[model samples]
Target: MTSMTMLEAINATLRDEMARDDRVLLLGQDVAQLGGVFRATEGLLERFGPDRVVDMPLAEAVIVGAAIGLAAAGLVPVAEMQFLGFSHQAFHQIGAQLARMRYRSQGRFPMPVVLRAPFGGGVRTPELHSEALEAQFVQSPGLQVVMPATAADAKGLLQTAIRQPDPVLFCEPLRGYRLVRDEVPDGDAPVPFGTARVAREGDDVTIIAWSAAVHVARRAADRLAEENISAAVLDLRTLVPLDEAGILDAVAATGRAVVVHEAPFTGGFGAEVVATISDGAFYSLEAPVARVCPPDTPYPAGKIEDYYLPSVERVVAAARATVKAP
Candidate 1:
């Protein structure tokens, strides 16, 4: 096991997958020579050469459109959008073309492409740099979405998504890229989608989250423990193929749930989770599932962004509400 940052782990996975499969190729802006703005693609250009690790022009639409053509021609292309907010430029290509290729062609062609984007706020990036747009992809059909909270899951899920025979929207929390470190096992370790990990077990309330919110839930769970409130933390690793069984099970055990995320509360991924629990575990639930999410507004400037983002106190308050509610 080696301790590595989430970015390093992702880079290692890309390198290993490229080495294992000749068809796997990476393309994006500043991916080759510049090693990406976050250095996630560092050392890849030298290791795999320019052909496999490519640096394309500064057009997300063209990059995604070209990736669609590449995938249609029988190559597993892992395309990167510099930031999640920029993916809007390729929505038509991704949502209309790449995602619908298999169904449109009746399985004659499969777009085995993984669209990777560094997402979420916390680093206080400029206007559009720190957006959490998972709900955009989640609402769209024909695309699988996965977000990893730890370095291990980041590496494992990226490898699995690269190998899957469909289009995958892999959202990596930018805040977790360098903030969290974990010892990842060597060799090919692919964590299957639709699985959730229990970060912490508790009986008071279940805290459901993904990506960076998983860390928030964990911290809140720890804080709750001090108050004699046991909060379970469930990391919804993959959002689209959400672990419905795990989520329902946790809520059944705890009898209460608090869904949390950095995304805005309105129409965010948390709504889907709350709906799912309401549908599947309504009878088992002791209290209405509450969501602890960002306010429904544009990410504030750095000065007040901290207030906009959900904090441990917010999560703890939600947990208390869930427990004390009639």
Candidate 2:
């Protein structure tokens, strides 16, 4: 086991994939020369050379459009959008063209591409740099959205995304890049999609979260334990092909559920989870499903973001409500 940060784990995965497959290429602004604004792609340019790790202009649309062309021609291209909010520029290319290529082409064209973007607002980044617009992608069909919580999962999921035949939207939690460190397994280990990991086991309430919210949920669970409330924390690593069975089973065992995320509460990804649980696990539910997420507003400026983002206290309050509500 090796102790590594989330950024280091991602860098390791890209290095390994590029070394194993010559077809794997990376394209994004400042990806090759500057190693990305967050430096997640650091040292990759040196290792893979300029040809495979080519830097492009500051145009998300052009970057994703070019990636589709490369993928259609049998090259695995990983396109980074710098930040999640900026992905809107490439929505047409990703949602319309790349997503439907395989079906429209009758399986003649396969888009083995990965669209990576840093998301969430705990890092106090500038406007349009820390938005969690996961619902936008979740609403679009034929696209897989993944958000890994830990360093180990980051490496594993990134590898899986690169190797997948379809387009994958890899949402990396900006807060977890350097804040969290853990012991990652040695050698190549790719975490399969549609799998949920139990971050902590409990019998009281099931807390479902992904990306940066997972850490918040875990912290809330820990604090709740002191008050005699044991919360089961479930990390939904992949959002698109959700691990319904895992979520249902956990909620059934706990008899209560609370879905959490950094996105706005109105039309957020947590709403989808709550709906799914209501449909599949209604009979077993002892309390109404609750959600702990940001308010329905644009991600606030650095000064008031702390109030906008869900904190451990807020999550604990939601969980407590589930247990105490009549």
- Global lDDT of each candidate: 0.92, 0.92
lDDT of 2 by residue, 1-326 (tens): 89999999998888899999999999999999999888988899999899899899889999999999999888999999999899999999989987888888999988899999999888788899999999899877788999999999998999899987998999999999999799887788889999999999999999999999999999999999999999999999999899999999999999999999999988898989998998899999999999988888999999999999999999999999998877
* Steric overlap count per candidate: 0, 0
Write the residue-wise lDDT of candidate 1 on 78-168 in tens digits. 9999998999998898888888888999998888999999989888788988888899888767899999999999988998999889889
lDDT of 2: 0.92
RMSD of each: 0.8, 0.8
TM-score of every prediction relative to native: 0.98, 0.99
Backbone collision tally, model 2: 0
